[model samples]
Target: MKILNIYRSEPDATTKKLVEIVTRDRESVEFDLNVDAPDYDKLVDEIFAADKTICWW
Candidate 1:
């Protein structure tokens, strides 16, 4: 399944580790404020495409 991980800020070590684990078998996408925030309109499309979301703010 598709998983969307939204970070309000840059990801920490734990966040990075989690992404690594989760993406091992399925698709995992991350949207971080430091990078993706400026392109929220495009990110929203991605968000909607995901089957699940993990929001870390």
Candidate 2:
């Protein structure tokens, strides 16, 4: 299951650890972008490419 996780700034320690464990051998990706300089085009492309998306503010 291709999954995409988007977050502004660094993710919490727990979330980081969980993602590391869960994404092993899995098609899961994460993007950490600046809120002011977000790459809308690339983000849209990833959104379409992924089967599911999770965003954190």
Worst 10 residues of 2 by lDDT: 17-26
- What Cα-based lDDT does every candidate model obtain? 0.81, 0.81
Best by TM-score: 2
Per-residue alpha-carbon lDDT of candidate 1 for residues 1-57, written as tens digits (9 for 90 to 100) = 999888877788987888788778998887776663268787889888999888876
Candidate 1: give its CA RMSD in angstroms: 2.2
TM-score for each predicted model, relative to the true structure = 0.71, 0.74
Q: Which stretches of candidate 2 lie over 4 Å from their true place?
A: none
lDDT by residue (tens digit), candidate 2, 1-57 = 898988876888977876777677779887878567788899999999999887766
lDDT of 2: 0.81
